[model samples]
Target chain A: MRRADRTLGVARGLGWFSIGLGVVELLAPRALARGLGLRGQEGLIAGYGAREIATGIGILASRDPTPWIWGRVAGDALDLGTLATGLGRRRGGAGVALAAVAGVTLLDVLCARALSSRRERQPVRSFADRRGMPKTPGQMRGAASDFEVPKDFRIPEALRPWTSAA
Target chain B: MRALVWHGKQDIRCDNVPDPRIEQPRDAIIKVTSCAICGSDLHLYDNFMPGMKNGDIMGHETMGIVEEVGPDCRGLKKGDRVVIPFTIICGDCDQCKRGNFSVCERSNRNKDMADKVFGHTTAGLFGYTHLTGGYPGGQAEYLRVPFADKTHIKVPQSLTDEQVLFLSDIFPTGWQAAVQCDIQPEDTVAIWGCGPVGQMAIRSAILLGARQVIAIDCVPERLSMAAAGGATTINFETESTVERLNELTKGKGPEKCIDCVGLEAHATATLDSIYDRAKQAVMLETDRPHVLREMMYVCRPAGVLSIPGVYGGLVDKIPFGMAMNKGLTFRMGQTHVNRWSDDLLRRIEQGQIDPSFVITHRIGLEQGPEMYKTFRDKLDSCIKVVIRP
Candidate 1:
């Protein structure tokens, strides 16, 4: 497919996933958290709820991923880490939910890395092989260090202490 | 043949030596049509070049007909009148490719030109110092020119040798300094060291449309020459250069300043004339940065500072902070001689400028030593000594 179409496809897929997660968390809160095997993750669920809502709104409204994908990756990572702490205090339910959060983090990291690399690898034509160009003499790296000879009488030689040298 | 050889500190002689010959494929043997003792040659005279093995030839600035071109030489032919720039280069080197022809990779005449081609960082110069290639200079009746095509500029047939002689070094060098200083059309430009380069810098500044060119030097003849060249001169011993600059520019001071004296040729009346050594190191080390201090004080905020002076290796106490505070733009480099000489020659052809007007002392080649002393003493109205070899 075309590059623009592929980009839009990724954006749409990411938007639907994040928005679905947001609506579910907002609607059920504790039950959704518990059903997702995060039995005691109240604080983490609340944070994810807010982040999901914001990411959902941004993704539906704007085509750019800078606002959407960035919030999803960063906000999900923080919420998942916090939720992992709460799950640590629970029983067998805790292990599955923590594992799920860890998987989400790995996916987010890989996507973020790919996106950043893509931006960096873009072509640039100017400012290439332009170092060490010849500059005029007396113009050093810093400001002008040249001092002008002062006006009026410079110190007369007769007054200076005369010393003979080789 | 006789050479003005340097024996030791303050010792020089005209002694018999074997004449030079065409030693390489690119070299051309030039019968010296004209050669003069440069202010820089005085460094070799004082044994400052540190290459004296009892006999070393000194003299680089020259104009002559090609006596013999090497077998491989292409552009130059026998009997072609050319003015040789001091910094010679082989055109096919890495440095030459980058247009830094002065420090060409194959500039060293002693070593094989292949040294630079093999990625050796050993580009040298003619008799400046051992640090530079230490090629023998052109003060003799005959000299070999390696890398002949790049080093020499072809003079126009209409112009006499005397008219275009200085396009080799001093004239183009001063022009480079002027252009590097970035002197504005209506801005005031101040030049230090009204020696030959300083004088030429003023002349070039006038041609480039400097509203006011103030030349700084204590030498009466040079100061007067600056005045004749239509520049306001600051005779450092007489005038307060800082005060005059402030007065002239309404406290903004000069918009651009050019230092032509470099590190070697800073001749001050306060210093002894017998040994006009590196005043730059002496002042900055012992007392204070005397002249540079003034340049800082007088130069306008965000002004241009051009230095064409020859500075030897390394010094401390350059006012690093002050330069940043003032927002000054600075450019400094060895003259791209080939770039500036052609246009300078055209000016002489058009009668728009006559730089030879500054030539005050005319002497034969035999008088090289004595003339060096005279110019060194700065005596008897000697603005520039022109020696006919």
Candidate 2:
């Protein structure tokens, strides 16, 4: 597979994953906060969920997903910072979540890098010499003027020029 | 015989299939020498056009030498070199007599189903949907051509396959698009897409003596090719197509607009395009008519909008009122290949234009499945792919 296509496939998978995870975080932010021992931060968690959903939609909808994947990488950093604060209160769930987020962050960074490199690798190709005409376009202009337009295909007679000057 | 067969969406396989046979008196079988992948075939590859069944052979642009002829086939014999037009036609039909071969009344074997879907049956097209006759196509080692007496264009041995191959479809399709415009000496023709048909339309407009030919496309290589064929190119990604066209025509808009980008109109370029994608994903709409909308909005009053692009099923948000008020003449249909093939063949023989310049990739029939994806994705700067079976 081409690098661009491979990376794009990965990006699409990640986009679906984001939407799924965001739905869980959004509808049950209070339960998620309690499990992570960050009970008071439920509102902040829900806001982050909305950001994830928006980024997911951008990645899925846009022709180029590079910018959206970079947005995902930035969101991962914010997620890691939030998880770090919960480490003091709960060691088990918060530690596990932090490790998982870090793994996903690595993937986001790699996908973003690969997508960027693919764009940079494509050089603009020129076909200036592939002019199918026997002569210059200017010289070839009106070359078929001798061929008559079929009667059925001709424009209305009223639309035709009445005189050379007109 | 190995032929490219459609199993499902995005699933084309080179499978060993039964060789075709003559079922009718007028049928002739040809040993296919060369064939091509057309832009319309992409509609089938993406599974957009309906009525396609599994195991249908896939291809349209084809040419070869006659290997066998049925008893009633008087115009063809063994060893005759011929290019098979994509549209199957019966010369005795009223539409055929009027030179509207694309809408021939009798060629489509599945006319009842087509009548329900399209009001009236169009021509039976090779390798297209079953609604157009479900006839087997020419992407294999041998093909069975029905109504072969009137359905083939004989070419002289002096011209190579590359020079006359497109007389079956794109060359005449593009020619008909420009002819629909009825271009005048002072008119400017603006073509959309810059794919093979767009390239041909550019050259056609220039040869017919249009004052200016402008090609709008986002692909750099395609734009460069259009420029090489005597057009002022517009890269739609970096500039506004409407604004550029208006400026080129002194704010009156081009007198002629041709839509070569049909259902798939670069689905993320503008807000309307994105809306089209979203709707298409949910099955709320069937075609993306972004180019249609743009042409309607920007064409000069009393101008012509000639469409060689193919569109299937429902389209949403067309500005019919705007077009109606503008007095724009709309001309669009499948190309009547036989109607214009003789003239195009003469042009090829006279060195007026070389249709072979559009081909970017050539491969054997077994490689057709992979090339389909490459062409669809615009990978490796592919503009056209020709297959030697």
Candidate 3:
């Protein structure tokens, strides 16, 4: 059976959202590092890109989104801590990057809450229920159970006037 | 019914074959409306995948309207449109119950042959070699679907045949490839071969949150298609994939790599690929796994490598030491289509993906012979072929 569309949709959205930011950081590490007032820490910015991408894939690849979304919360905390460190450093656009990071933190918190609560509402379905068919295996016999080659179905002999080996 | 029959290597013909009827209690006969020629079929076309006899009907990816059913068939009725998964399942075995339907114990009639080769038998596959199961494929006017209730999925009327057809194989195959990689948002994935499976892997990686997807191939059309699917393309003829990938990822190498090109991978100046090709031609090697070796060498330390490509027999000189030293996590298998079909179908319905983007040709079943050559030779920009039987 399929997961609730809203849950998967949100998870996929957040996954792409993380990758979008990750690309910017990976491609323009110096620019992002400077904007966040973490100049000379371009390598650190790229490291965060790697972490963000990983979190996104974790969320997309699994049915349960709570743990990965929670990891995003922790990442938010790290971003804030770094931004806090950058507040006293000499840099440009630090305030802007901090406000942007704070906004994303809010989004991460909201997603984590939604995923955690939905986990309670949506219970896993049993195999029979998920199969979505009318009859169970017990109610039916396999086609080849009492094996006998069909009389009319001839095995081709691969020569002129193909003949049945059976 | 008229069916495409494999006579021998590079020789397929549309021949008059006996109409498929309900042979067993749970069987159903389907009038095939749409079917596809898969990349794996090319292996059989080239005589790479073995155990093919002269009269084996060829095809597996199929969707059709149910025309008849046997006494025990319960879930489907006449006139129902259904998509048949390539692998047949009994749904009662330990493997099937655990959702490992592709390796189910009870399905394969020729289990002894498979067991002898692989040390254990695998699931029975349609239109695949006798090693899997000698069940006739779907590239014909009519097909007999065994285990009808569990093996075929009913499709809603709202979706077109093209949109849902791939639920049979490649979509699930590619999806499993991406899922097994254990992708993190920080991961960069590089996929070899821009074929259908590779293209699907590109889309799967993007959906699964890969940061940068580097696609490697020599085909211009396939490379362009991969780029269109949001990947950086690398033409193996023009660029060194390993070096270019390292350069693209800032000397760290991609964290994940996928080998979508299986046994018959191509090579250029790479010493290993050239050697593999020479050995393969001389019968010393069963497969040319150029991409497998490259993936191991280019993957970052502790990276994950996923293989969706089909490898029939044993591989030689796989560089196990490099994979071990690099701490690479390896995942490869025949797709568990029964497990992932529903989810991928839902994804299609929701407009998250349209699998038909990979289809480059659509012809009647009679064209099977020529299309086989065209597909294998990569002519007419062929990536995937859909047959209207």
Candidate 4:
């Protein structure tokens, strides 16, 4: 597979992963907060969950997922920052969560970088010369003037330019 | 015979199938020389239009040499070169007699189902949904043409298949779309989607002497092609389509608008498009009428909205009140290919336009499945794909 296509596949996989993780975080925010030792920050976790779901939908729905991948990278940074706050309360659990977030963050950054580079590396092909006519477009105008518009297809007489009152 | 068969959504396979025979007295079999993947076929490939069953043969734009003829087929004989119209028509039907061949009454074998779905049975189409006819399409090495006496357009041997093949669909479709607008010398015609049909519409508008032809699309190559064909191109991604169209027309809006972008309007960019995507995701809507909405909004009052684009099933959020109040004349239907084929063929013979310029990819029948994906994804700048089956 081409590098861009491969990265796109990875991005889609990450998108589904984001949605799945967001669902769990949304439905069980309190449990997630307790596991990370950030017991009082359930609402914040839920907000982040909503953000993840939005980003995921954006990634899957947009024609070019590059911007949404960059959005994911941004969201990952926020996730890592939030995870860092719980380190003082439960060093072991928070450390594990921070490591997981850091791993996913690395993926997001790599995907964003790869997509950007590939987009820049490609050249836009021009079909400007493919006029599909023997003569210039100006010369070809009204070339089929010999043909008559069928009576049924003609606009109503009242709507014709000379027939209508200005 | 090798042919492209639809197994399911996004699953077209080049498989060995039994060759077609003359199944009826009017049936004629043709050894297909050139068949093209049409924009409407993408609706089938994506499983957007319903009535496709597993193992259905897929293709519509086809032309070939007659190999066998049934007893009742008087106009066509063996060795005759012919281009099959996508719409199967019985020449004696009331609709056909009125030149509305696309809605021919007797051609579709599955008429009851189509009557239920469409209120009245339209013409049977090759390799389209069962709702149209469930007829086997011409994407194979051989095609059995029912009602062959009246369903074929005999082409001069001097013209190549690429020049005349599109007479079956897009060429006539675009021509009809322009003709339906009744374009005048003072009219400005705006066409949406620069796919093959859109390209044809652009050339047709210019030939019909529209004062200005503006083509709207996001694809760069397609935009470039549209410009080459004498349209001022709009990349909807970079510019506000409504604003640019208004500016071009000095805020009067174009007198004629053509929608070549149909059910699967690109789901990014605009808010309504995004909403369409959301509704479509949950099965609440079946079509994205973004172009329909935009055309109604921007067309000159009492102007014509000619839709050569195919829309299947229901669409939401159409501004019907605006269209009704503005006195906009909405003209939309499957192309009556026979209605415009003779004139278009003469234009081709006279070098008025070469439809072959739209062809970006050529492949054998074996590559049909991969080409479907490539065409669907708009990969490799594919505007049209013609298979030399």
Candidate 5:
């Protein structure tokens, strides 16, 4: 697959991740707040979920999600800061939640950087409309670098039964 | 030279095996430096696989310093430190041309036997059973690497063996698993098994942008390891995995599910596992695919199910209809090891990720036999075993 497709794939995956987490935050704000040691802050958690959902929607809608991806990076910073507040409460699930947030922050930063790099480079072919079709040998062959097979390249006697003819 | 030889089931010995020599024109003799005992090696140790002969030097995850090269060998010379991929490929073959080196057509020496069993022959493997070409393995003082130019990945001296050693199998296998998931930006990946490949898969999923990873296993240490790798863990013994997963994903289920535990899956409590064990003991089945059924059950509609685990022969009670009905994308196979090694090495060098996090035990070569049992039984929280010869 092309690099653009991979980047887009990751972007899309992040969007869905945002949506998934948003849904959880919205429906189970109490549990999430408890896990993050933000007890009695269920309303705030739910609001953040709404914001996450909106950013996720924006990313999914835009062909160029670089700005929204940057938004996610910003949101990740906010999350880290919020999780940092709960670091003092090492008991309960606070530590686990903090670790999880840190991990997700790293991913957000990586995605942001990847999209930024791609935006700076030449425009890549969009995989959006390329309906799933298996590439023929001709299509796949071009990317293969040209290299000469040694003139003496031959299957050894012991390994011949396992090898097929070139 | 001393090598770890498999005599029979539950029988491995560090014996005085003849040192490997360059036997093929494209071969090179590598003075083995670091080798690992893989989870798949347990399949042979348990006598689960057919065609394993006594005295077979058993190892595939290996790195060594090149000692000699044959006349036809290219791109390698003596004194080069290299990580050897388990799958052997003839680089000039059609499969290799397409970068599908794991399925290289002209690499397996016993292609007909494989063709008869699997309907097609895959690439030859090092130190695996004859079913995969029976090339003498690298769990020895020296190894004869066939297709040296294609199979061996040279590493610079600056990097330690632990950093690049896994390019041989598990690292790529896990990366391939994550790639095969066709992960979307917000995909939640649920991985079964917290072994080395599973840990690597968890990391790969995170690096590839998995929003959340849910790891399922029964072992406490493995679960803690998965948690350390940033995955939420569910002990299959204490909690209901399917129920918890459903709750975690709000009844929609995770978008990607990876089964890293293959044929020797255990669940003494579940009826499915009991049936699998009874059937397997009677030779009625060759595999126990409990994790596969769970994946099909818990994966979201149109989700991807990637199997990095190894399974041989036929499995019974698979939820094929459920998988088809859900429109799940299934991707499983022997890893195209050579395809991903270079990029992964670049990632390692750039500090994007460290591959050494999975190594829990490192020991001398003589301890190979006991360590195999320790790893197989999950003693000492053994996650990965690397042997220095």
Candidate 6:
């Protein structure tokens, strides 16, 4: 006899949900780390998710909301991470507390939602000037030194055929 | 009905041979009610099956009613319905003891049956050739089956002729392919053929929990049936099998691949579409080519390769090195008729699987000769054929 589809469907759906949860935990380190009792700078390791999500979203949301979206996202992400790890921890080097780590995780989740909402505006007065805004691939290439590129690569050959009007 | 005795190459005819009778202590006489013309039968017709003497009876896959039995035969009653497995084995031998009924010590025809009677190394089998045990097979209305208690599976009373018919060969062979390959939950299997055995292999794969099954066949009808069985069918005539398999699997390929067609069933490469056109060069003696090689090519590394297809010890041109390099676990042999029958019967009885689905035609016992010719010629739209006495 065939198995009930609903049973298997729910099981698979739950798996995807867990992946998202893990991703959230990895995005912000300092602020959320200690609150949830993420021990021994574990939150820093977990912050890899937040860093990836920030950079990914920053690259994707490079339109009219450039600074407003990416800037606020980068700033608040770092700020929330620091507060969760610093203020939430005991002044005299707080020991790892599960509740502390969880509290920080909840704050990071809130920070993500806040940043996603403000993600609609231009880059804030933080990073680079947003004037003339949404950069093309070539302009993004020109702005390359602003971000690290692996030593093995250079401006892509895709732009080599782009003859200048001058 | 007269038997089509194979005398020599291209030499055959009807023979009003002496009637068969129970000879062994555990023997039973079956007045064959239905028997199918199997591809193996063609081995005798084409003089390919060895040791076929002049007037040797020919046929293996069959079913009929128990007409008589030796007094020592306890399980089968007169008029009882039964389906006989192609290979016979006495459960007392060493091979039988190990549950390898196909390789039973008493079945090694070349050995003396009485010399080692108690600690017998092998036994004989019904017709194909003298090499297969000079005992006559079921090409006539009657046949004598030794080891009746251990060799025949009692068909369920409720099943129709079309439903329990192929329990004799194709059906069980397909199941054997699936089981031997160790098909498991979410396993992906590919079967090479759309003949009766291949079709059943596809069915067994799904029933055994293979998440995806790919079937390769050139015939339109057979390929369509494979698709109906929930397999992703590929017409090797039109598409590159390697490309299709690679596309189906995200490049890694299927976990298990079965060569149900054996060494002779592969349709010849580069053939025209017409039945006669595609089959012009393909005779009963045709050899299976790249299909086996292709199976090895597309199967996952370290996967199991199960061959339920019959092959003589004389097969050549195989890629042994590649098979070794890929770490393929190969398992092949004649079906351990005695070992698999009871469990397979229960599976059928419980409706876990229906083996008769492969039966394509049912004829009378007297039609044996014509049926053999039609099936051999691939003339009828027949996949599985049965004869009613």
Q: Best by DockQ, which number?
A: 4
* Tens-digit per-residue lDDT, A60-163, candidate 3: 54435677788988998988887787887665777777798899888878878877776555432211121111232122212112222223211222311211
Clashes of each: 20, 0, 8, 0, 12, 37
Q: Give the per-residue lDDT digits (tens) of candidate 3, residues B281-367.
A: 557877878888889999888777889998977679989999999877787888888887877787778666778878889999888
Interface RMSD list for the candidates: 25.1, 2.3, 22.1, 2.2, 21.0, 31.5
Candidate 4 residue runs with Cα over 4 Å from true position? A1-5, A37-43, A90-92, A121-123, A157-166
What candidate 3 gets wrong by more than 4 Å, as runs, is A1-166, B267-269
- How close to the true structure is residue B317 of candidate 6, measured as C-alpha lDDT? 51
lDDT of 6 by residue, B101-149 (tens): 7676665455653234324333466776555477778766788898888
Candidate 1: segments with Cα more than 4 A from true spot:
A1-166, B47-53, B109-123, B265-289
Tens-digit lDDT track of model 4 for A1-166: 9776799899999888888899988999998988898888999989988888877877786657888899898888888898888899833388998999899999999999998887676556788988989998899888887778888888786655422221
| C-alpha TM-score for every candidate | 0.64, 0.92, 0.70, 0.95, 0.70, 0.63
Q: Tell me the tens digit of each residue's lDDT in model 2 across B1-389.
A: 99999999989999999999999999999999999999999999999899999999999999999999989988799999999999999988999999999999999999999999999989999999999998888889999999999999999999999989999899999999999988888888999999999999999999999999999999999999999999999999899999999999989899889999898888778889878877887799999999999999999887889999999999999999999998888999999899899888899999999999999999999899999998887878899999999
**How would you encode candidate 2's per-residue C-alpha lDDT over A1-166 as one tens digit per residue?**
8767789999999998888888888999998998887879999999988888867877886767888899999999999999988998933388899999999999999999999988777677788888899999999998998878888887675543321422
Docking class of 2: medium
lDDT of each: 0.64, 0.91, 0.80, 0.91, 0.81, 0.61
Please provide the root mean square deviation of candidate 6 (C-alpha atoms, Å).
31.2
Query: Top model by TM-score, which number?
Result: 4
Candidate 3: global Cα-lDDT?
0.80
In candidate 6 the C-alpha lDDT for residue B115 amounts to: 35
Q: Encode model 5's per-residue lDDT on B1-389: one tens digit a residue.
A: 99999999989999997777778899999998899999999989988788899989999999989999999998899999999999999999888998788888988999999999879999999998898898999999999988898888989888899889999999999988877765544667899998889988877776666667899998777777777666888999899999999999889899789999998887344678767765776689988889999899888877778898999888998889999998777878899888888887877776666778778789988999999987887766687899999
Show model 6 residue runs off by greater than 4 Å: A1-166, B9-14, B112-123, B265-267, B270-289
TM-score winner, 1 or 3:
3
What's model 1's lDDT at B237?
Answer: 68
Docking class of 3: incorrect
lDDT-based ranking, best first? 2, 4, 5, 3, 1, 6
